[model samples]
Target chain A: MSAQSAKHMIAKNIGVLGAGQLGRMLALAGYPLGNTFTFLDTTGNPSAGIGEVIVDPENQHLAAFLDKVDVVTYEFEHLPVELVKQIEQHKPVYPGSRAIAVCQNRVEEKTLFDRLGIPTPAYRVVESAEQLAAAAAELGCPVVAKSVTEGYDGKGQAVLKAPEQAQEAWDSIGHTQLIVEAFVDFVREVSMIAVRGRDGEVVFYPMAENQHVGGILRYSVAPLPDLDPSVQQTADSYIRALLDELDYVGVLALELFQTRDGSLLANEMAPRVHNSGHWTMDGAATSQFENHLRAVQGLPLGATNAIAPTCMVNVIGLEGDNAALLAIADTHLHRYDKAERPGRKLAHVNVVASSHAELLEKVRACQALIPDAPPVEWSFESTL
Target chain B: MSAQSAKHMIAKNIGVLGAGQLGRMLALAGYPLGNTFTFLDTTGNPSAGIGEVIVDPENQHLAAFLDKVDVVTYEFEHLPVELVKQIEQHKPVYPGSRAIAVCQNRVEEKTLFDRLGIPTPAYRVVESAEQLAAAAAELGCPVVAKSVTEGYDGKGQAVLKAPEQAQEAWDSIGHTQLIVEAFVDFVREVSMIAVRGRDGEVVFYPMAENQHVGGILRYSVAPLPDLDPSVQQTADSYIRALLDELDYVGVLALELFQTRDGSLLANEMAPRVHNSGHWTMDGAATSQFENHLRAVQGLPLGATNAIAPTCMVNVIGLEGDNAALLAIADTHLHRYDKAERPGRKLAHVNVVASSHAELLEKVRACQALIPDAPPVEWSFESTL
Candidate 1:
């Protein structure tokens, strides 16, 4: 794992945007590769507890940051596209500015998906309540209306059972523009993570079945036992297309709906490492964080194959008893060092085992130790 | 994963003595467990390169270091015993001060091995050249004479091929006290690492066959294919006795030599993590670094079972082309962020595979890419 692109590798100062858990993990992975990190915190509330952070609430320290780092990569996608574009002038930015631009707006993301022939739920961009109702009528009932920009998790989203509720949904989601999508009746939600190096080499991890509670990911299990090889190939092809189209130089996660017809419909994609791929930390041959750093550093990507049947159980709000959780076999705890609060992601537990049954058992044992953890359930359980 | 012994886990500030690569890795492993680090560097030059370093050239910042940390641990065993003893009064130190005291003096270490009924090479502690010659004559030719107080990595030591060379060996060692031991005719060298928790429970890793060049560890392969199950049991029992005897609560490594008759002889032991156990980072279920932190933090020790056949190649003196090395499948690089110099350990690569045959193939491929790497050879290759 080289830190810089040279005949002989040398330590590089990696500039990171957004000081959150993802940045913290990136620094942890990058440090072993002989790289240092300097985080640019825009909100002045950096949670990536480790590393040197620059509080740049007004973006006045951009020149200082650009002068210190050899390359720049972001951990969070919500950063202003202009900020990333400006940094690109002084230092190389992985995933580029187009990635941030498209990911910031759902309409742009969907348009690219449509142009690239990646199937997505029927959708239309609307700016007013009347247009939202019209789009709902055209797409049919049970549509999800979301603000095109500045929406994550379940924020700024509303479900309209009928076109008559469009006005109420529009009022609830306080945004200038919205993307109304017809809800797909799917069997389960799944995501595939891929990394594309600077040399245009791409690698994909096995699809992970996701279980979300209140739109926040609760659990993710990789190498789904019931997943057909064709389905995996389809996912790989979909993400490969996205990676190449964006010329992505880091990890990209594509979330999809696995319908009963044995087809995948693209739901959304994240330009950076996604929560659904955290299971790779212990389950895959190389973690997503490490692969992301490798790609950003212009190094060859690592093996993406799953090492075993693994599950990631998110510890949200309240944390579990650390000693009790670690006492469980094959459980690895990763704490964010953030104080406990309702609806906050405090930590996650990675459970790995030789078989899916054993993995589920360990996951259940792990979940029992977490305080206020959602019930452990997976769509592949019945197949197993 | 708990940082303290309380019912609920909390982020702890860990105090580490000796800021070196071991301490850097300990902090890397500890950060995920939701702990912060503060290092006490007795030497002005600290190679840790990370963490909050308190350089106390005259022991002026001991109070500040102690004030910020909850529990204390040492990465190097050669620290001043009185400094550790003083730190013990303010904070709990894992492995205790007695472990350091015994490890610092070769005579004390050998005597403890004898008291614990651990077999060792024939040896005699000598104070003068005349006594050294008598001990060499008694023990036989080709005896190793090492300074009793300070000797490591073939330093402060000399080999006397004949009794008449005792004066030369004594003069070379430059110490008032020396321990002379007869060399053993062994099949090969091997080591076993074990971690003991605060509860007095012990877990041992599978024996790793080690290869050394100029007394510095060059390579180590774990879960030796030809090793008898009884041999592993013997090594485990030996380390377990040592751990309990010293009331040790951290990772301890014991080097041993396996004779042609399939018996193990105790060579020496390290109070902290050893170079031979670095393979555990990728090969075992739990790494030695994480286990050491867990033990020091009063948490339960993790599983020490090897996940696959693994080999660790030390990057000494020079570094390999990072891109070429990482191009190999299942190869993991961990650099210490140090400038390359003669006889310096810059980094290491961990190669893993499902079977020993495949692992050997990969290890050979990985070695070819490293600059100045020794030829790849393994004791288990013939068995494979």
Candidate 2:
């Protein structure tokens, strides 16, 4: 190649399927690498707040969006699989339609996990309250029933304390099909995020132990002090199997449960960058957003090494004092520019420190600055 | 205080005076902080590809630009001081008109240095060829003559090896007034970048040793391994004095010459975020761009600690292979989206590593990928 062509980046206009915080961050990371973005927002309310937006509620602008972008990727997997498949014929879509189809269905995702020999909470698919009650009876009471589709962020879900409550749970979910899963006595919730490049190259970030309050992720810290190397390896292998089986490209996040015996059960997987990896923005050698962009762009994957012990605190619903939150040392805030709304992911603050103890201290201090921020909680903090 | 107000970043439409790479980067860093930007391009040709640009070649849209923004900051200091002063009446301009006035004139800048007790190369100001020759004879045989105003990147500058070359140098420069100084026999050129908050809180980054070829910076590396803590302190004090004296409310970059005895002589100061500090984008806890925006917006400054050893390579005149450059591990490319031309800075590559040896190796590998990149050289490299 001539030197001129070699030195210049082949600037690509990436077509993003969903316009949310994930896509906003992808564009933010992509721009520095000489890429442009054209977002195709299926929802009428698009919150990317930056970049070019094509609000095609009826898919009227699909052809126009395809014409502008070199490659396509979705920020949220809730996108219609047929739309993704159609776009694939026109442009290359990372992770492809199969990953999305499986991820969108609870039964399909669990079946894939079983086929791949990945362990998960015992689950049974049911189309009626009678079957749900039978499944709850077989699995044990206090089971969780979730809609087979369109479920996310603890939405479309209900807990049945007994077989008698199964009818109420089914009525509450209001879905024709449901997956009733027996609750696992896991000690903590954790997630592993990995990225696979176009060339089938894969890199994994350190496992992050997560804290969820009211079914929303409140905090995540990576390079867990209490996590065994073997436990991390098992999580890596499980995700790697999924990535290879689906011929995936871009970042894939697998949410898992770490049990008292140091075993992990796969809870679910996201075909795009996950919120648990947001700490990588300031804590890792390369952020998950940048890695996702690089993977979809067919560039080499960057190192996923952690730079420090870091915590990511999600700012949900309400905003906090901008000055006070920032005053805490090593705090980096990323605001989504959305107005205050209940349960909305408005922003997140990533705090980095030399040690995990110092990190916890700062995180608690930061938590105090945000009004009504969930009380700072971490499974490892007690051990520390 | 209400939690809602505290959690929100009061979004501001920043009015930038120049639309160059620096302005482009400032906007890139500012966006995640939930800020917007409008560039007021005084020059007909502006290179900031992102953000809103008001091309006011005749200053006709000055009022419109001012009206759109809450506060103003300039990327390039060569702007007309009177224009900044006029804008100050309507809105705040950080680093103010006084900073621009002193930075635009060599005499005023050197006078400020003298008043603040900062050491500098012996110099004399002259208005005629005879006076220039007299200054050269008084300082020594070999002297450097620079234009009093409007010179940057080695432009409007001439080096005299002998006193007799003054007339030819004078005609070559074509400037009516010039400052001639005896060249200091320095070991190496270094720079200190510091940010002063609106309340006068100052923080300094570890000094970066810079390499220049034909007056354009080619490479810069920070947290020099061979540097003593005391030297860094001295450099910090020098810049702190300047920041306090000017009442600077943004990032200030000071270039200095380190003599054999480890003493530093002030070369010049730029009243804005500078090229040498670009390494902070990937290597520091808080990037210079973000700190500059924070200071101007009246927010607390983020930490300035270096994450690791880092090097920044400038892409000048020609482009290199993007894939090859990025293929280097831990390497990041920031392209300005500009067409390449002779002496034009098109992009930069930031290579970071845990140790100086590893950093040097990666930087060398990165340098080889660029078509016409200068040799990777650092004074501390030999020590490593």
Candidate 3:
């Protein structure tokens, strides 16, 4: 279709189910494109600073909020699928409830990956302590046990070092439906952000190598320096299969484990804009937040090519001087207005440079100003 | 001082006096930096679609709005000086009331240019029909007569083609305080945007060559192709002197007329972000809007380097398919969400390219989508 016709079809008002940093960034990205946002959160504080926030507890005010928007999408993937289904009855919700339902359950997510021939660790479902022990024995002595639902940020999961610990792990998790998998020996963790539009157009951002501390992402570097092409290709094929299977119409983030032999194994997926893609705000031709809005709004997707080498470091529980962060040359600081709390993401800094070395230097300079931030030295070398 | 100390001093909220496209753009830029905006206008529709707008009629409710923000600034330059002075009593206003007071009148503005050694077209103040005739005779025929206050976008001004038209021009303008000046026979119109920080740091963006139709700006091409270094240096010197003189703490724009002999003549000045600088949103490393916020908040200034050759075309009185404009590659569209009128500025399209030739191609492509837009072409070649 011509650009003119496509733009006339642009959604005037977009709705997000959750109001957080992702929703705030989405509103910020959509503002330039002439889209207003109405967010439905438990409280008004989620996106209160950026857009209109409607408090809708028990889905009582959902219909009224939906009436004000043309389309609906969610920020966090853990929203109740039934609530999204209720919204879908009134208006279209991008990445639909099926994708959200599958991602909410570890077993369902792994089963979909298996059906699509995506590479993943060996896994088996367990319902009770006896089943958990058997599954751990079958997978091997060391395995990761994850609950079927409501798991995130290293929560609702446990690692079993031996068969003897299987019962203990299951008991600790309250014996919910679980998936036990043989842990992969990975060299590093990386993620790729893919956007699939309503017209079936798909674009993938370069993989971002990530670092996590205590299950929370601490930093990420895009275009994963010295990454093997075959590894990226493998990850892309899996993302494509998932998008096709789910009929996805927004950004889908796939996290993978890069093994020592440069092979990729799917770890998980996020049905919305992911933290690893934050660097795109400064380093890419278009940001993931903007592209996500385009996909959900059914507009033409923007360029996803990286414009520079970039690194993003999350500011967790921040109480330092923001002026110090803004002082670094070429460093873009994003501070979410949420109150600071331990282990909560308060802000992030994206350092962009014409070259990887310069980006690293600036990233290190930014890291020095924030307390408790991890050191800024990368283990990989640039191959580009 | 260390960045930490500087960040600790960052302002929490900002207020804009007028909620138009300029204020909307400023809010978009400041959003990522964790700043919230409260706008005060005659009605809510001006900045209604974006930030919170407080209706303050007759400056009766100005103090209540001022109490909600940390610092205050404005979008339009023609705001009443007395009203701004009243707000200044409670909270700080960037670019201050003094700059606004001078720029609101043509005579005071030209006087400042003269005192700062900035070359301007030869002009004389006119208070009556007799003085108007004398000034036109002294400056020769074909002079421009402009009302000293409340004139913008070609309004409140008239050109006297012959001595006989002097009385007619004076009567047409309603005999307001005016300035009659020798008409500049220049090669082209250009403008420079300079941002001054609270710490006395000043940075100038590359000059933009502007095209105006009936006094409303139609398009702008940045880095002003084939611009002489000395001309740029002269413009910079003038901006620096003005910044120092006004103790300016935000973005200030100086529009100039380039002569056939490569000399520059000052035309006028704006105390806030100018329309010509809109291209910086997609073309520069840091947009003028963001820099203006940084200046007001007392944060370190961002980079002012151009990332590519860029051109911006205003979508005046638009009533067409926005999709066509968005379809152009590397084109950034900003719609102000205002009701379209016969000649109102509804939106703008920014086209960025690696080469000037490519930029013109995309700019032309965008122009073709908007109804009644002027043809796109650059008469000058790049000197860099």
CAPRI verdict (incorrect, acceptable, medium, high) for model 1: medium
How many Å off is the CA of B188 in candidate 3?
Answer: 2.2
> True-contact fraction for model 2?
0.75
Put down candidate 3 lDDT per residue, B290-329, tens digits, no spaces.
9999999898898887878889999888545676666676
| lDDT (10s digit) by residue, model 2, range A1-384 | 765674455647888998988988988888888888899998898988777999988879889998999999988998779878988899999879999999999999999999999999999999999999999999998899999999999999999999999888889999999999999999899999999999999999999999999899999998899888999899999999999999999999999998889999999989999999999999999999999988988898998999999999998888777788788989998988777889999999999999999999999998887767878777877877
* Chain A TM-scores, candidates in order: 0.97, 0.97, 0.95
TM-score of chain A of 3: 0.95
Candidate 2 vs 3: which has more TM-score:
2
Sorted on TM-score, highest at the top, how do the candidates line up? 2, 1, 3
For every model shown, what is its TM-score relative to the native structure? 0.97, 0.98, 0.95
Q: Model 2 off-target regions past 4 Å?
A: A1-11, B1-11
Pick out the ten consecutive residues of candidate 2 chain B with the lowest summed lDDT.
B2-11
Best by TM-score: 2
Instruction: Evaluate all candidate structures by whole-model CA lDDT and list the values in order.
Output: 0.89, 0.91, 0.86
Q: Candidate 3 overall Cα lDDT vs. reference?
A: 0.86
Please estimate how well model 1 matches the true structure, expressed as its whole-model Cα lDDT. 0.89
Q: Summarize candidate 1's per-residue lDDT along A1-384 as a digit string, tens digits.
A: 444325556438999988889899888888888899999999988889887899999989989888888899988898878878878888899989999999889999999999999999999999999999999999998899999999999899999999999889999998889999998999899999999999999999999999998999999998899989999999899889998998889999999999998799999999998899999988888899999999998888998888889999999998788988888877888988888789999899898888999988888888888877778888778867
Candidate 3 ranges beyond 4 A from true positions? A1-9, A43-48, A137-141, A228-231, A381-384, B1-9, B43-45, B381-384
TM-score of 3: 0.95
Q: List the residue pairs that clash in candidate 3.
A: A3-B323, A3-B324, A4-B323, A4-B324, A7-B323, A323-B7, A324-B3
